[model samples]
Target: MRNDRQPDRPPLTTGAGWHRRRRGLAPWLLIGLYVVIGLAPLAITWLRGHPRQGLAHDLSSGLVMVGFAMMLMQFLLSGRFRDITGRVGADITILFHQLIAWTILAFVLLHPFLYAVPGLWPDPAQAVATLRGMFGSDALRSGGIAWWLLILLVPMAMWRDRLPIRYEIWRLSHGLGAAVIALAGLHHTLTVGTYSADPWLAGFWVVLAGLAVASLVHVYVLKPLRQFRHPYRLVSNREVADRIWEIQVEAERRPAINFAAGQFIWLNLGHSPFRLVEHPFSLSSTPADRPRLAVTVRESGDFTNRIGEIPVGTRAYVDGPYGTFTLARRRASGLAFFAGGVGLGPIIGLLRELVQEQYRGPVHLLYGNRVETQILYRDELEAMGKTLDFRLQLILSEPPEGWRGPAGELTPEVIDACLDGRFPKDWLYFVCGPVPMMESVEATLLARGVPARRIVSERFKYS
Candidate 1:
């Protein structure tokens, strides 16, 4: 019998499981809260019959700024910032984040009209006149500019694909725009009345300003300073299969951070966090060896495609040891790994960890690629299998001529064949891949009597 205990992975312990009941439905809950919060100001305005005479006058701007901050925090917590935080994958997490962003935009559109307009809201001309009228006065100029900048930037960012800009460049520009908007907002707060005058509102602004500054420091100064103190020089960079690169780094520090098998880190390649362009790669090294680390990365996306160009001997910043997608905490009669495409990064890391730990448990590796040419770390996996006590099975979806391994997709029959009826049903399974492959593999596994609890899958979706 396999041990079914699930100790929470340390990296994922910071409030990740706290919202378990509200995971998928968190957006709806946030929406309900948003509606309530928005309505508070409107209700105040309704009772007072004037904009400046109620709590809404004090709370509206603060609410807007704080709400924006909350939504951004949601993005960070949703795992979209997984590269920096090293938490979970940004799969479904990003979906919730997007929902939050859209919700904020909707509120932003409605906020001004409820307080500024007189029964002419939802009317295009009146809303335009209300916004345009603010720009006429010197006192309201900063607020008008801030509001315009936010309105322009948010929509441009929401429809980034239509914009004539590359993702990497757009990311930098978007960050700059946010800084401008924030600065303008600060100027407006200083010049405006109500919320800007109250000590509590003033304190809230100070705290928000501090948070922004701290986040900047965390990404730039603190993380980089730590890296400088514990220098990790790049030792080897090999071009693995499917144009993926395996980077081996040697840490000079005495007590380097230890990570479990199948974890990942955010690599800051000469770009400051202020630039908003760091990338995440899965650690392909074992945890037993603490002074060194390795990560295999596929050359996809704007940031990842530049990995091939990263010169060796260049210093890199690593912020991680995150992700709960490892095989460390589970006990199973047998272990199975299902990897698709570049999803092999974590699997390779886990295998190396298993070898270092000298795990005698029966383990299996089922990897899939489009073709033989796209199979990454093939020779390395072959060598590792020879030395380690684990079975290896390669599946090619689009195998060319002269291929001898299993062909076609990873169906239930292929899984049964690989496990040799020793699957033990209670065994833990780790799966990593694109959405469709993961769904198919999960469905097939469930059908074959594998309990949902026995399956640990990480889906990596691009936003």
Candidate 2:
């Protein structure tokens, strides 16, 4: 039998829950709107009564127009707008951005080639000669430039990690190159496109292109100006575990940025926001500790390795309160958390919130590390167990002698043991860790009768 005790937090049927429901639905609304916009050019071309240039030429023009619309919308998707990513989560947003890029690229690549198909065109040689003329003509220079630039841009982005350039340099070049592509693509469309000669369609392209440029300016200019106004100062930086460092920042004058328990921010230390020196990190502190925020970072990348050397009182900027990995927008009777290595950062913030809210439901935490020394905040977790109806299970892949706790990876059997035959379907499970660990835990939960909706997970890296 279940305890059936109510938690101290508001019920899902309340006003707060309604607000969350609306927020969750907003993403789908935006997506539907985007699809409609992307397909609008086709409808306008039909209404304009443009003469059909056979099936191949018509299809080629349609593909290019739709592809250009999608390419323009890509700027908005990657603009770091909270309204866009707040409900869908940043990981999903970025993944969609990457996947959709390939689709648009395919359309662009096939646009000119489709007309060259021998059976589709009445005169194949004429089609080939037309293509050569278009490519060779100085009047169509913008189109040629856009075509080649896109060919270079997509591959560069896809293989960014394999490149020798620094991440910052690559990021800057990506933005600049994208701007050039958009401008050149716009010029080509207005000059060469048959349907774009229509006033309505021409106006549509101009509006979309203008919006795309505005998005860039917002990200690179306006947002940074806002961040400069409300700066933060580094208060403390300490090595917590093996290579993990706990960083704390305090608001200098303005109030601290309020955020949900499990959200993250792009932290820029000792650098202007325009420098592209920031990195995303999950918050490890709850809102209950307002005006002061903390993030736990592991020494992996170049910037993170020198985290210990950052001087206190250094100026910092944060652009965030992003990601939908928090309980504020979710509802459940009980809660379960699974963390691996530094993935504990957001989980710990959530646990603190649960404790602060006086949540009286069953809670379980299954944390895994490679060794005993790598275990973080062990004493604090133990202390939390005493304050709430919490059970903490620590698992180490390699344990020292005389160790009595669970050993080895968090396999299905180990997870079953951790649950101790208590499987609450109503409980919401949060899993954060390395990609493999998260996948395993999600699969095990689903296999054990947990619904997919009940299992929520967050990935540290999108790629």
Candidate 3:
């Protein structure tokens, strides 16, 4: 690693907005809002002052409203809202969306069960009769529809990969099913809910449902129309590694999206953005690369398999420069990166940014792959070591004969060996890889006394 250090020209802390401490308030604020709205129905119900409907019955109604509120709120947490997602990361928002789905499921399943709770005493037969009577009622038909749809909807989303369905097909079914569920649930609430008779409570449900519909319109209609007006042209797409393609696109017009390195976009190519056809990909070119945006993707998934076939000059729609995994908000004396396989894309882009900025601090990278052929931009990374005080350690879990460098999985020992000895615990770290590997590395960092706030990462897929 060479270090002909020059006077500091670009400060890492220049964009104070990215400061983790500054942005920390957003997640709490969002969580507070979620709690308030989720409980708003219960609050209104209590205030409306209904006669005693028994504790179990009142509890069941409360659960139904909160669950429905959460369902509607799901539209806002769909990773498409920048104002919310900017402070609360896209990954966190999406994961929360998935998590809250299960909670909603619990509430829906328990609502009817709780209604029959009083009869489940000395004789179990009474509970069964209570449930049968409730199910037989014509007024509860909409509730039944929403309940059944929800039962199918949540599991479908959770095990989507295991089921033999295309992503687009699953997505279409998901959206349609959710809409029906919301509408039916709204109908049930407004028509049969004990508290629904109160005008304020009914109006609250209407407002939430309308917002839910507006969110759908914003994503499927409004945003796409905006993208259509400001499209990008595919300038080049070529193979960069074994089954890995690097795509570069230039703004069709004059304005290109400005983003920090390591940020990503939901890329819709050739296909109209109105269709649920886009995929999330990290931007692999430096922010300095301007109107020309680039992404490196592996040959996996339905759409990526044909990445090589996309001809130049094809139109593209980009939905973001999202994610908060960059130096823009962080302050550190040195930097460390851990990337696995295709994870090298954003890490390489960050390195490029550092080189472009002529960063003087020491930088270290640990990139792991199963074989040498899986490595992307081998020569380029080596060349980067010459420009900045950069050290790169290539860890191969399955290396070929005569391999000289460290070769194995990224264990604690391997990490310790690559640390350059002088790097301190406070140096900012970035990790990108398969979920298991990323988790292992993150745990290792935390165990080694790295502050949680000092480690930055982004995940598009969550279990």
Model 3 residue 298 CA deviation in Å: 0.7
User: Global lDDT of each model?
Assistant: 0.64, 0.85, 0.85
Q: For candidate 3, write residues 318-363 as lDDT tens digits.
A: 9997787777655776789999999988888888888877776778
lDDT of 3: 0.85
> TM-score: which is higher, 2 or 3?
2
Scored against the true structure, residue 176 in model 3 reaches a CA lDDT of 84
Which of the predicted structures, 1 or 2, would earn the higher lDDT when compared with the native?
A: 2
Instruction: Tell me the deviation in Å of residue 437 in model 3.
Output: 1.8
**All candidates: TM-score:** 0.74, 0.94, 0.93
**Per-residue C-alpha lDDT of model 1 across residues 1-463, encoded as one tens digit per residue:** 2454332332221221112221122445645654554354334434545445444434555456555444334423335343432333344455555556666665545556545545254676875676567657788777677677767876777788888888768766665666566667666765673445555545545565555546544655676676666666676777877688888777666565667667667676655444455566777777665677888888777767777777777666676666667664345555789999888888877777666555555678899888898887778788776655578899998888888889977888888888775555656788987778888889988888888878877655545
Cα RMSD, model 2: 3.0
Q: All predictions: root-mean-square deviation over Cα?
A: 6.7, 3.0, 3.8
